[model samples]
Structures are given as structure tokens and as C-alpha cells.
Target: MAPVSNNVVGIDDDQRFALMKFRRSVRDVLKPEHNDHFLLRWLRARQWNPEAAEKMLRDSMKWREKWGVDTTLATWTPPSVLEQHFPSGSTGFDKEGSPLIIVPFVGLDVWGLLHSVTRTDIIRLVLVHLENYLTLARKQAQTHGPTALKVTVLFDLEGFSMRQYAWKPAAEMVFTMLQIYEANYPEILKICYIVNAPKVFSLAFNVIKKFMHEYTISKIRIYGSDSKKWQAQVLTMVDKDQLPQHYGGSMVDENGDPRCSSIVKPGGKVPKKYYARNMQNEAKKEYTKVTVKTGDKHCVDLLCADGDSVLRWEFGVEGHDIKFSIKRRDQDGNETVVHEPRKVSEGPPDVGVLSVSGPATYSVIFDNKNSFLRSKKVYYDVIISVPERDLNMSDEPEDLEAASAVAAS
Candidate 1:
């Protein structure tokens, strides 16, 4: 027996509708290879709920637009900041053809690295890697039948501390990253092992896990870190030669040298020249203050008159975190969010900037929806600027004010 429908062979009505909506919204970015298998990954992540799955897919597409992520996939290079701070990489494939990516946190310069890059860059870097992972997964799936569009994450948490995960900004970033992963990337992580976790590392993760969805939380395993038990389980998944020597695995090549070229050893110094330029965006900035209590909200509306204009923002919090978004209202009095919801940050930390695709009222939302007992105090500022341009219509120019309006249509 077999299922049959206009939908993929396995998906139902709701899942099919979700896929249809995604194609309609971002048809330009779609490649022929983004077939049912890709759709199934998003469908399964939301447990086949059409509405939830559609929103996740939409948000992800909008995010891709603002970040120029689609173009990044083809031509983007990893920023040096990522290479210097984040000691993570894909080593090799497992028996099932799933890629294995390892992140060694022991003695890593997490604090220095966290401050070195803005939240957006961090997200961008992670997404780039994920995009790369998907590329490999798709190729492997062709050779080997049926595969989950996900990767195995091995988080080596040895010697992690308050200085690393305890920082409010860093913790918030991790939480936001988790939210993005669960809502958009969904089910993309095949499995995760928090190996070599020091007891204190639990303190930091306890707070971070609160933001993770139940489905994702279920896939995580905190095993015997830095012990025989950890190595045993890791070896079962990855060959010893695929691992680094310091972790009791072999990286030695046939000539008695390092064999694995993909592995990245933990730790590196970001040169002084790049540090200041990297931190310049995050340096001292002014902010406006407002309070939003539970079920309450504070919104900042920035109006742009032309497409290609930029809306940039920066903010900080006093007591609790707030949800942030960029939204525009359609003619039917409906709101379509323009940027993926900000899952982390007091606000951009450095600056959150998006180039307007059309003239519209871009709303910056400070939602305290998750807070219960207290009001969140947020200090922020936004700048909307545009370059002058003529529509180049007729000998006489049309009103410049019509720039954004014309673009919106």
C-alpha cells in the first residue's frame, strides 16, 4: 500500500499547503533540487502542523532575504572573526553518511570571541555552516538512500564556566540561537552530545535550555564528559582517526602526521588589526528608555520613503529581555513580519540594520510576551535613511516622496 496526493508522496494536506506557501513567497530563491526531502525536514520539525510549519518557513525566508543569506550560500566567505574564535568544524561522515561536526569548548576563548563579533555575524556564520552541512547532506543522500537533513553536534564542554556562558549577552545569544534552530532549522540537528561537560557547565545550560523547544530538548544527551564513557559513545559514532589526538582519538596520517584536514584545534588569536573594526559597531551608543509589562508592548515605527533605505537600531535592557521584530502592514490592515523575530540580544548590541525593499511603516516591536511578574525596561534608538534618486520617468520628475510607495506596489 502507498499514499497518493498532489503533495509529496508522504506529506498530507497541511504539509502540502505549507510547501506551496513557501514556494509562492520565495520562488526566486528556489532551486530545483529543493525537493520533497527538503520540505519534509521542515514539515517534520513542526510535527506536521501546517500553520506552525508555514510560519516557520516564512520567517526563515524573510530572514534569508534581510541577511542576503541565499546569495551568501553561493559566494560568501567565512569572516575571520569566526575562524579565530569558534573552534568548530565538520570532520567526516559517519557510517550512515551523516556529517559529524565537533565544537571543543575546553579552554576556548569564548568571552573574547563573543565580544569580537556582533549577534548578526554570529548567526550568519552559524547559518553559513549549516548551509554547507545541508549541501553535503544532500549529496550524500543521493549516494545513500533516505537520510535526515541534519548533522551530529558534539559539544565538548570541558572547562566551560560563568565567564563563558554566564555572561548575559552571550547567554542570550545562545538562547536566541536555540530558538532559531528549533523554530526555523527544526529537526535539522540529527542528534547532539554535550560531552565532557564539567558540573558547573550545567549551571549555564540550565538557563539556556529554557528557551529550547521540547522536541529539540528531547534529542540532546549530556553524557559522561571527559571520561571513558564519553569516548566510548563518541567512538561508536565517529572513527578514532576522524577525531583529534588530544581527546584519546587518532588524527595521525599514514606518514605519522595529522591525517584529517577538516579538523580545527581549539583556540587562535584574532589579529589586533581586525579587532577594533569588528568591535566598532558595538562601541558606545545612545539609547531611549521604555517599560513594557507582561502582555504589554512598546513599538518603534520607522517610516522610510524609498526602497534601499536602511532602518538601523540599537537597544539595551534593564531587567528582562524583550522580543523584537520588523513588520509592515499590507493594504488589508494585516501585518506581515519582515525580519525573523529577534530571539536574543537586548537589541543589536552593535546595530540592527535592514535595507527596505519598499516604502512602508517598519515597526520595531519590544514585546514582553514571555515575562510575567515584571516590566522590561528597554533603551533604544533607530535611524531610517535613504539616498536620493529619480524614477527617471518623463522629462519632469515625479515626487520623490513617492519612492517608497512606488517600490511597495
Candidate 2:
């Protein structure tokens, strides 16, 4: 293995050059705090391919802008349910000085959570915590060196149940979070220790692990309910002074409870009063209505003239089931299925958001061709949103020129 100019091991001359090239191409978007170590994470994720890394970084920046990661997240207040029941905390750092994040996995009441708040709010809550932990790691890196640039997580799977995840919404939320983490925050995990996993956990892990990136999968170490085995492993990486006594460590909360209740809120079932379903009708957005005749398909083409746009949709069929899918056609007339066709019912609108890099047309299709008896009426709200960019801060021209220069070289 060769070393890069930044003293990051395992990078040869080619990778170093690619890193430099990738850095220059995205210079306009780089924050004052971003360094070669940050760029290398993206490069390594894309197998040291500069162009691929650039695309990934640019797309992530667009997502951040749209989600207000830099602007609103700092001051955003989470719903009370989340503030009281969200189960995670950082009581210490790993041996290498990386921030240690502990998640009481069994405390995640996905069903109660989704009912209490919009799915968007749940995702935003996750983002707020992730950003906060990453910020901690960045700060620790100043004293602990690059080794502290990542986070070490301990997921206590005691009482973990697969029942909630059996529900489609819960499962979808898991995948959505995994996808978001892998794409936007690559290589941020120093390690992940999942302890107290029941034997049945293998079944769930087998399915969800498929959604994880190789880098992420490689860092996970799973253990059975044997406390001694897992405790010993944890103690090796985390000092007892920085960990809660409940996990074979010496630290305790101010009240002297071993579980560190002050830091890691033991999230329990959310009260029914907070259910968003009860208030759905109070404020509703209008939807466009259209009918797809029997043996015919209705398609709505949403043009994303600029790449890095987000396409969001909510729809439901009236009185029957309808097959819905999304496809993208690019400048060369190449078509690709963005979402596989799925049968959606009239119960709740099938809602989803897709991040697309496109100078392309996205077709939202409601197919009723298989239904020979009756036409299907679809109620849908679809929008293509571009991140609001500050014109004074815009760097499109310079980014384009840098990309051209890199390509030419």
C-alpha cells in the first residue's frame, strides 16, 4: 500500500492524483472544514473513481440543500415524542477517541413513531442526531487525529422484535435510512457492535444487511445474548469511565441509575394522543385527479431540466387497486425503471421521494391495462423540486469549468 500526500495510508500515486482531481472538481462546494480525509472517504466509496465520487458528492450536496441540513437543522426542534422517546446517546469515546454512540435498539417504536409524526419528521430527527455525532467526531479529530474522524456504535438488541418491521411502513423506513446513510455519509463508521441479539435476529439481519454497503457491512460484529462475551469485547474498545454501568462499565447517570437514563432516553411506546392519523384531515394538500381506463395506462412526465432534483409523490387509487411505477428517460432516450411497479390500495396514498440526478424526464405511470372490467381513478400529487440555490453563492460555472479541466487532463 502507498501513502497519499496527506499521510493517509493505503493510497498509491494514482489514487492520490484522483483525490486531487476530485477535490478540484468539487472545490466550489467544499466547506471550510472539509479536508483531503473527507474527499478520500468518497473516493474510497466509489473505488477511487474521481468522476463517480464527484457525482455522489454533488448529489449529496443537493440533498443537503433541499433538506436544509446546513441551515435549518441546527435550530430545528424535534417533535416532543421524539425528544422524549428517541433512544440513543453518546456517553463516551472509543479507544481511538472516535465518538461512541449507543442505541437502545429495542426502544425504537417504529409503529408508534410513524403514527405520532410524519415520516419526513422521523427522517429529519435521524438526520439531526447523525449530524450532531459527526460534528462531535470532527471536533475530537483535532486532538485524537484522523482516527477519531468516525463514530463507533453499540446497538443493544435486548428485547428486539421483528414484529414491527413486518409492517411495510416500518420496513420501508429502515431501508430509507440505510440508503440515506450509505449515500450521503459514507465510511463514517469506525465499527458497530450489535449485542444481545436473539437467535431470531439472524432472519432480520439477513434481509436488512442486503441494503448496507460493503464498507458498512464489514464493520459490524454481531453477538448473541451472552453478556460476558460481548461485554468483554466492548470493554476493549470503550473505557469503563465513559460507558454506562448497565453494559459492564462504571459510569452511571446523575440519578445513579446504571442504564444512564439521563443521556440515553429509554424510548417507550408513544401515546396514541400524538398519532398524526387523528389529525390528517385537519390540514391536507390538494391532489390532481385522473382516470386510467381499462386496458389503458396513464403517464405523467415530470421534466427535471437540471440534474440533482428531487421528485416527490403521493397518490391513491379510488375504490380499487392500481399498479404504479416510475421511470426515467435521459438525454440519449435511454429509459430506466426508477421504482418497480407495485400494487397500491385506496387505504392510504403511496408516498415516496426520489433523489435524481437528471437532465431527464421522469414518468409517473398508473397502469390499469391489466384491469379489463373497470377504469381506475387515481388521485395524485407529484412535484419535481430543485434545491433553492443562492445566486450570490452559486458555483455552477466554476464547477463546470473544473470538471472540464479534469476531464481534459
Candidate 3:
């Protein structure tokens, strides 16, 4: 057979860069006699046909359009984004000098979901074969100082419900890996998470607060969205004292000797304001409840609140009429505030609604006086209110025919 063309295939730009570097590193080790066999074997292992390798290379040019695998160079930046969020200092570094290794703890289902949604081959690349490559990179970085060390993690949220997907494992994995990295590689400035979310950002703050006990690193920072509000909230909680005190040590009344009174004297009232503020803050913790009707006319009721403050109240209707409103009440149980109602024409059925049962009522409460002031309780009630029309479960032939026609063509 004739000599194979210099063209290569079955690789993305990042892969190609890695391949080129690999080729260069082994150039001296691979004598001319070994070059063709080694290269051919590597290509074959990747499922490239020896006879069709040239065709694949030529085809790769069109693959950019047909497969949407553009080889455009990615803009390179310092991995500071990861570092800023997950700073891995010099504690976990191996004696031989390698970047800390991070393994994600996401469920397989989440992995599959992300794979299907993203369809990025590099995702498969990392999931399947990046560990070995990362090890090599870490070794190289160690020998060359921080320039060679790199850290990265992957996240998938499939196992979690849509609501739970907001955070949990992703945030936990990123925070844990950062902690490990910081301990092992103090000189290494950053680490990276492959995906991002608001909850993950919040989790990072939680981790920072926890870390504060042992390390005095700067507060964790997040970019994008109303991050400042979240950061401020988290920091304020972290900085506040969360300890309870016994006030007005057992006092003696004028008539008694060593009287242990139930009430403390004047000094006891000093902490009352703080206690009330804490209680009010706890009462303000938010909760949600939902109600739905399924039939010719679909309607949904949502109730959400924090303490006496109603965060959300809305009734959504299907088809011609959809409306929602929210109201808040004061301590006296009177409606002190009302919000403008929003109305919109009905469109498609909400999958979120279909997945859940009807007439749901959700509530959340916080214990304002808890030493550790997190939301204390969350409650949910779902009531299904099926319409009378739905009880007569017979498909009309005309309706079925129309639906089939719409589905078919």
C-alpha cells in the first residue's frame, strides 16, 4: 500500500493538541522503524480503519459542518475562575509534586442526563479516559512548578429531583476537592468545576465558613446572578454569634433568701431585642405549597410563605384564563399588603405540574432562637383535585383521530 497521508482524524482541537504533544515527547523514543506501526496501532485502537484513515481526515474537514465539531481554537485563560472558587493550597500535594486528584461523587443517572443534554465528546473523553492524562499532567506540573499542575472536576445532577438539582452533590464535590487540593497543593492557585449553578455557588460559601475554623482564607466569591445578595446573607450569618446565653443568674427577691425566680430582673431584658430579631428572621424563612385541577379547565394554586410573610400565592388557569396573585399578612393576622395580580393566556401544559399531584400546599418555618439559625422545617402537601369530566375515562374516536393525525404528520 502507498504511504498514509499526514492528515489525522477522530480528534477535537484539544485532543489534537494533546496528541501532538504526546507525539513530540516520544519522538526520540520511536525510531523510524517503529513509527508507522505505533501510529497505525494507535489510530486502529481508536476505531479508525487503516485503509480509511485518509478518508476520515478528508471527511473531518466536512465534519466541522456536518458533525458540528468545529476545530476553532478555544480562548485560553488562567484557571483562576476555579481557583477563585476552589483554592487548593499546598497540603495535598504528593511528595513527588503532583496536583491533587479530584473524583466526582455524582450518580450515574446524572452523568447520563448530562451526557445526553450536552452531547459534548470531551465530556466522554474526561469521564472515560481523563484520569490517566490528569495524572501525567500533574507529574509534569510538579516538576515544572505550578505551571504544570492542573485540576478539574465533572458534575451531573440527574439523580436529584429538579429541585434538589439546584445543589447538593455538585457543590459538595467541588468544595471537597478544593479542600483536598488546598491541603495538598498550596502553591497551585486554582481548581475548576466543569459545570456551574447557583446552589453550587452557595455551597462554596458554606464550605468557606466551615473552613474558617481551621483556615483563615478569604471569603468564597461567585460570579453571575444576584450573587452579592447571597454572599452578603451567608457572610452575615457566618459572622453573627449563634450561641444562647443564660441571663440574670438566679437572683434573690427582697423577701426571700437564695430565691430562684422564673423571671430575670432588668438585665434579662437586654437580650430580648436580639432574641426577637432572631425570631423575626426565623419567621421570614420561605416555604411553598401548590394545588392543581386537571380536566377540561386546568387550574393550579400555589401558596408559599416565610413566617407570616406570604412569599407567593397564584392560581394558574389553562386555556383562556390564567391568573396569579400574592399577599402578605402582619402579626395581627390582617392582610397588610397586596401585590398586583398577573394574568396571561394559557399555553402548554406544565410538565412540573403534570409530574406532581394536585392541590398542593407547601410551608417552611424557621426557629428564630436556634443557636445555629438555619431554616428549621419545610412542609409540603399535595392534593389531587381531578375534575368530574376526567372520571368518565373514555377516549372519543374523533378526538383520538385528530390527535393521531397531528402526531403523524
Candidate 4:
């Protein structure tokens, strides 16, 4: 394989100089093994602008420190529910020696899984696995060359259902994962093969792909349930010995099962017994408690100055139910419903994350006007996160603000 560096192929003298400049700008943080290949990723993501790439790199480094990414693989253990039902595994390496990840997409029970664990737990679980795989890729790169520093994924979406994602919380988690990956782990994927896709998958992808970075979107290939077409393509990149028997490869599990359950866990519906609401002492102390009286509403105005910023919220009502929704109010005072109002009960908290297009005010409203007698007590936390690529380290706090209002009837 050819050396993976900016010096190869279509890159010219100007691009090479930009890459060199980016490397020098971040010299204080780069490891001895952090070669031109690694630096090129950030540069390309920032359109070869060394200064923009530098800010992105520094922001990502801070994010890693905040998440403890360097030590997550050593310290974090996924909850039992995720360990058994996460629906993904690193099964083999591609022809270029990049790790091959297999995900039985249909087995993902997002609704059930969230009910069993916190969203933070799910994010940490993904981070831990990513760290583990990247560590393996880096180690392999020493022998297999720099091309091994990424992963190839196969998403088997045979029985995909849009119903689950239609539920707001499930859709939120999906977009959150996509945004987090694109912001911090840019260019980590060599290619993604999404096979056995149903027609409904297109609708879901159209909505969620808006959250993905261009580099990530360009590497994805989607195909229908034609086994002959996809299997042949997969075989060209992965040897039969490395892939599982179920996916047109010769490898099988210890007991001769074709699905290779030993390596790739087949995630299923999480049992209701594992629901977090059933577990005691689940509330965090950080939530702000607010009382919404009958014939009144509580609204939180999150001002977003930039497009592609994320708005996330987690809240729960005590003893009863409250109608929750999100509305976007543009500069002209035109109001549009972002999330339609729905009744949220006193279990597991109504959690959601949105990639909002802004220069608009987003109102997270808890409505109680319909109730003639009951006053709901709501505990909540709402936040706005700007993309790492767009962060201005010295900007004032007013760029993002969350102000609360209690409107009485």
C-alpha cells in the first residue's frame, strides 16, 4: 500500500504547505507518532485552512480531556444492558487492515435501551468502544501502514422500522450520536456499507444525515436487500475467513452458529425488568425544580446565534403528567412548532436533543393550561452546545443563553 500522506496524489505545493503549517501550529500537542496522515484529516475537515484546523484540534483535545477519553477504555465498563444489547462488534479487518465493524441495526432497541440507562451512559459506552478500536487501529498501522488508522462498518438493516425513531427520544439519541461523531472523530471512517435497507430507511436517513459532516456522508454507501450485490462487494474488501457466515462469509461461532454470536453480540429487546424508573435514587441533584400551576405554562428560551448548534434537554414531572414541546420563534416573530406537544409522564424523564438551525429563539415549553386542578412540578436541565469547528474560544457567554419565563393565565 502507498504511504498515507498529503504528498500523495492530487495534493499540490500549496496544500502541502498548508499541511506543514497546521502541523507546526499544533506541535505542542502532537505525539511522536502523529504523522502527516493524522494532521491531514483536520485540515481537510476545515477546508485546508490551518488556523481553523488548529482551533478544531484544540477544541477536540479539550473535549477529550473533559470526557476523559484517554482513560475511558481502562476505567469504563458498559452497563449489562448495553454489553448484551448494543448491536455492534469489531469482527475483522478490511483488506487495507482497517478494523471491520458489524452492526445488526435491526436489533437496536433504542426505546427500551434508553429506559434502562441514562443518555450519558450510552455516549460513554460509544466513546469507550471507539477508543478501544482506535487504539487497535493505531497499533496495526505500525505494520499495516497508515491506511489501517480507520474503520469500515457494515450496517445490516434488514428489519429496520421507522416507528421507534418516530418517538422523539429515540430520534434525539440518533442525532446526538451523529453530531458527536462528526464533531470530534472526523474522518475516522474509511467506508460505511448500509445494506438490506428498507424504503423507510431513506426517510430516516434524509432527516438524520443533516446532522452528519460532509466527509462522513461521502463515505457512506447504501444498498437494498439484494444479498448477491452487497455480499460480493463486502467480500472484495474483507476475506471470507474474517467475516461471519451469516453475511456470506465462511466464519462461524464456536458451536457452528452462522451469526458468530461470540464476537458480534446480537442485541435484542431489553427486558422491562431493567427499566431505570424501576431502579431507586435515579434523580440527579443538578436539576432545577419548577412548579407549573394550572392555567399556566413554563417556557425556556434558548437563544442560538449559529446554525447547526445542538439543543438538548432532560426533564421529569412529579406525581403526574405535563405536555412538553419545542417551538422556534424567528426574528420576525413567526412561530413554528419544532417538536409537537406530547404528554410526558413521571418515568425515566423526557429526554431529547435537536440540531437546530438558528438565528432563532427555541422555546422549551411545559404546558399546563388544559389541567383544571393539577399543578405540575417539573425538574429539568436544558443546554446548548455549539459545534467544535465553530467554537470561538474567547467569545462572550451571551452567544448562548437559556432564560426562563413563567407565564400565568
Candidate 5:
């Protein structure tokens, strides 16, 4: 069998030449850290088509400049958002030497916090961690090679609820993170291990799964909701010494109890002391509402002139399934599927961005026509928002204060 290059089966002389040309085109933009391993990720993201990869790389460069990603890496950190809204910790390394983040999901009040603060700030908080994550990952890669240059997320889901799992706003955040992380920060998640998840979690997870690529979905390993069942598996992936004692490891505090004893003591909310002080003054995000009653259909139309143009959308359903489809309609009224029809659910963010090929009316349809007695309603916002179109930073980062807060805490 022939080997695959960027998921493409055949890579001939022309393709190789094209790849070299593409990399050369972005020579000035390449930082010292932008090595073959780094360039290869963008290539794989575009399936090794040099033209597509080149376009992606150009757009990403423009985006990085606009967002001041390097600047953010040097200066930004949202302490209140981290400590109050979403509490998380950077623990020890994984078996591959990648940095590990132990997220005690059972403790977070996902819906409550989304209601309290702007979802935008929540995302910024994640960016703070992502910035730090890369620094740690680079150090790990120095020891274990580039393959170790990713973060492993072990979701401690002991007390996760369907309420938190299926909540629409939280779902929206998940989708937003999925889009941003996948496009801008490709090939970064080494693996995500989820443990002690209840059966009901699957329903919400099925919705969450829609936002993930098959390659990404494959990296996730669920250890069941049973502690005994996952303890062995967790122990195998991480050294017992580094493992949090809550998961049955040797990490202990001064009292000789689990290191995460308070944080992981079943379900609890982040305390008032840590809640964002200026949350009320923060600008909130906006969303468009879409309603679909029984036996009715709705479709959004966009005119795509060229393949260079990107199309993006984000939406959440109100606890019901809506049939979603993206198709291209031609002059003769012939419709061809761009994205196939799937039953869109009430959780996770249903979002996608792709470069369109043919010029025509691209329609995003939501069909509730099949349901006899039930009606579905969804809140959504669609943006044919292309990459790097507007090169501007809209908000100021709380830099020094955030750093001080983290250090002091």
C-alpha cells in the first residue's frame, strides 16, 4: 500500500515542489520555532494540498498578527476568569512527557458562570492556559521530541450532570473552543481521558461529539463512571506519584489527604472570593434566535464566489433535534451537498468552517418537518466570517494585574 501524505494517498514530484514553494512563500513569517513538525501540521490540516495549505498558513499568519498572539503569549493571563469562573490546575506530565491539566469538571458551575460572565472572557481564560501550555509543551518536546508537544486533558467527571452537560450556553462555549483550537492551534491535544462519567453524560456527549473531527474523537478515552474501573487505566497513563490522590494516587497534602480533597470533594462551586469582580462591566456576546415548529423548514443562504472564501456558523438547539444541511444550488436548481444532513442536537456547538469550491447559493437548512408532535427552537449566530479579513484587536488584556493575581494565589 502506498503511504499517505497529509491524508492524501499520492504525493508526486509536482506536489513536493508545490509544498516546498508554499513553505518558501512564508519564509519571513517563519519564526525559529516554526520547524518541519510545525509546518507539517498546517499541511495535514489542508490534506497536503500545497495551495490550500499555503492559503491556510497565510490566513493564520494574518490572524496571529491581528490578535498579537505572540504579544498575548508574553503578556496576557485572565486570573479572575481562571480562579473564579473556571478553576483548573496544571499538574504533572503524561507518559509522553506532555503537560497534563486535571480539570475537576464536577466542581464547576458551567451554566451559572456562563450566566455570570461574558462567554468571550471565558474563551480568553482558555487562551491564557493555551499560551502557558505551549511553553511547557516546548520544554517537554526538548526532552521527549516533537511528538510530546501537546497537552493531555484528563477530565475528572465524577459528579457531572446532564444539566451541566447539555446546557446550551456551555455547549456554545465548547463549540467555540473547538473551532478556535482546531484552526489556530492545530495538533495540540495529545489525548483527553474522561473518567467516572455517568450514562446520561453520553446523551450530551453525543451532541458534543458532532463538533469534533474523527481524528480528534479517536484520541478520547472514556474510563466509565466507575472509579475502580478507571483507576488502573489512569495509573497506567500517569505515574502514581504525580496522579492526584482523589484518583487513588500518592499525591497528598499536609494533612496526608488527597491533594485535590477540597476541590474534588463531590460537586461544589467556585467560592465568592474568586468570582470575577468586574464581570458586570464586561461586554456580553450576542446571539440570533431561530425557531422551528413542527413540519416547518428553514434555510440560510450565502453566495460563495470562490474557493478562497471561508464559511462559518455557530448554533445551539433547545433540547430537540433539528435536521441540519449545507448544500450548493446551481443555476439549473440542482442541489449538491457541501455538508450532509445530520440531526443537530441541543448540546455542543454545531459549527464548521471550510473554503468553498463552486460559486453558487450555499444554503444551511434546519428541517423540523418530520416531527409530528414536537417543535424545536434554536438560538444561533451565523458568520461567513472569513479568516483575517479584519486585522484588529477589539479588547484590552488585563496583563500585569492578572499575572500578579496568579502569582499571589
Candidate 6:
């Protein structure tokens, strides 16, 4: 018999039998019950020609290598490399052309007593206000370009010793901001915190460093008091230089020698373990007692007095509120109706919005008329709600189920 050309061939009886056997073997290996029907069809469609089938299999393997096939598929495209599909100034833009704003609030004192509030609780409040601020910022930016506004929070540490709760609340706030920023706004340029003590700044910067490392954030700048310069520099150093080394681990040659040769051995600086231990010890110190004559007295005292007084007052009864809510536009075109209202008061100068995520309208309502209360106090209220049905996750069950099944397989 004449040899068949590579492009065109007639299947002889022997060839046909071999092809049938191959199909049977493939089918047996990939049981229909175990494999998807579409996958089976795909396999069968490529079985007619051996070269085409081999090419298809090689292509599929390459695809699997390129895209991955794990249960929870993760395709990591670096931010710098990824296509900027959306137009410039699309989402997450402030009026002043900043990407997004994350305001971290420790408490109301800036040096006052540590309130009897949990770090988690404070973070929740900050998140609520942040959402409202972002909603307002986004609308304002869209309508009137960008505007410059710093989201400030009073970190009172009076009655509470700085050693006790300084880093804890600050760390929590930074972590929460990181989570919200990662989930919603990847383009956030700056995060500002109106902090009191140098230690609190250090603690918050440590948390920020952690997130910066995890997310590969290259540039981070902090502006605070001179006392915090050391802490800020530490954060910048850890973030810009050390974190990558830690995560990547010591690179070793085939013989296991460290890849980078150093003339001077690195040691003698304040180690993280020791630093953490010291912070914990400081936190355990006894706080000075402060007289809270009225709700506003603590605030006034902290702001007016020296640094020592401010730190002491934070631990005292300085009223502060942290709230979380979605800002939504009502039918009448006004941003109102914040979901889940929570109030925490420690004197006046309300701790405004901390961080916001997702899409919604937010409004900062000041109690202009103190009709009910005789004292002239400023408190902030937030309104948050979803704008469209598409944004709601109620109808994603079927897709979720399919994905879950695929994942299990």
C-alpha cells in the first residue's frame, strides 16, 4: 500500500481499530461520571487525528502551566504590568486628584486616656465613617474634580497609660484600612492619621509595614510629629528594604551559602521580638488618674495641656464614637440613609469617617441645632446604602454552586 501524506490520510482497518482502542482507553481513564461532559466532548473531538490530538494536549498543558488549574485559581498580574483598562480618573479618585483617602483614628484625645473601647470596635467605627467620606469624596470629585481633605481622628490616651493600649488600637486601624484598600481601592495614594503619641505612630506604622509587605506596596509616606520621625523612618525602611528580604527568605547558592556577601554582619539593632515584648510591658504600666468634670472637659484638657497631660487623659473618660455605614442616594437625589448607626462619644469634635469600601453615598451630618442638648457639641452621623440591584449578591447562588462543584472536582 502507498504511504499516506501527513495532511490527508484514509483510515485503514488496522488504524481504525487502533484509534478505537485509544478512545476506549482514554474513556476508561477519564470516567464520564468523574469528568465533565463538555470535557469528554472536547477530548473526543480531537481524537480523529493523532498529530492534532498531540498538539491539542501539548497546548492544554501549556495553558494549564500558564493559567493554573487549582481549585481556587489565582492569577497574579502585578499592578504595574496589568493593563490599565479603565480610563484615567475613573474610580477611587478624590477631588484633589488623589487616588483614595484612608483616615485612621486611634481615639479622640490625641494624648488623652484610652477609652474602655475594644480595638475592634474602634476600627469598626472608623470604617463606617471612612465609607461615608469616600462616597462624598467620589461624588464631589466626579462633579467638581478633586479636592484636598485630610481625614483626621483624635487619639486620646489620658487615663490610660501609653504603654497599655498604644500600639494595639493603631495596629488594628492600619490592618483594617489595608483590608478595605485591597478589596476596593488599589489606587489609594495616601493614608493620614491624626495621632498624639510617638509610640502610637510607631505601632500603626508597624501594621502598615506588614500590609505593604504583603501587598508589595513600593511607596509609602507618613507625615506626623517629630517624635514619630524615628518610627516613620523605621516603617519606611522595613517597607522599602527589609520586608521583601524576609518574605523571600535568605537566598542561598547550591552549597547553601547566603547569596549576598556582606562585609559587616547585621545585628545589635532593636530586634522585633524584643520590641514587641517592650511594647507589651509598657502597655501593662499603671495609668495616671484624671478628673473628668464633664464630657467635654477631658477633650479641652488634653488639647490645652502639655504632651504628658494629653497622654494621661486618653485613658480617662474622653468621649469618642466610631461608626460604620454605607452612603446611598435616595430617590430624591440626596445622599442619606446610612445602614447600621453606632455611636461612641468622648466629649466633642466627633471622630469623623475612617475608611469606606464598595459603592454607596455617604454624608457627614453635623448636629447644627443643639435643640435637644444645651451644650454646643459637634457629632458626626453617617448614611450608607447600596445604589443598584446589580451590586447586590443575592442572585449569585447558581454560579457559586457551579464554581464550588468545579472546585471540588
Best by lDDT: 2
Candidate achieving higher lDDT, 4 or 6: 4
Best by TM-score: 4
Give lDDT tens digits, candidate 5, residues 150-183.
Answer: 7888888776665453334565566667766766
**Tens digits of per-residue lDDT for model 2 on 292-386?**
99999999999988655556677889988999999999999999998788888888666665666678999999999999999999998887765
Worst 10 residues of 1 by lDDT: 390-399
How far is 338's C-alpha from truth in model 1 (Å)?
42
Candidate ranking under lDDT, highest first, comes to: 2, 4, 5, 1, 6, 3
User: In model 4, where do residues sit more than 4 Å from their true spots?
Assistant: 1-10, 278-409
In order of listing, the candidates' clash counts read 3, 0, 24, 0, 1, 64
How far is 388's C-alpha from truth in model 1 (Å)?
A: 38
TM-score of 1: 0.58
RMSD of 1: 14.3
lDDT of 4 by residue, 306-355 (tens): 87676767789997899999999999999999888889999776655676
TM-score of each: 0.58, 0.67, 0.22, 0.68, 0.60, 0.25
Error of 1 at 180 (Å): 2.3
So what's the TM-score on candidate 5? 0.60
Name the better of 3 and 6 by lDDT. Answer: 6
Residue 105 lDDT in candidate 2? 87
Weakest lDDT window of 10 consecutive positions for candidate 4 = 395-404
- Per-prediction CA RMSD (Å): 14.3, 12.0, 24.2, 10.5, 10.5, 25.0
Q: Regarding lDDT, does 2 or 3 come out ahead?
A: 2
Residue pairs that clash (backbone atoms under 3 angstroms), model 5: 196-225
Ranking by TM-score: 4, 2, 5, 1, 6, 3
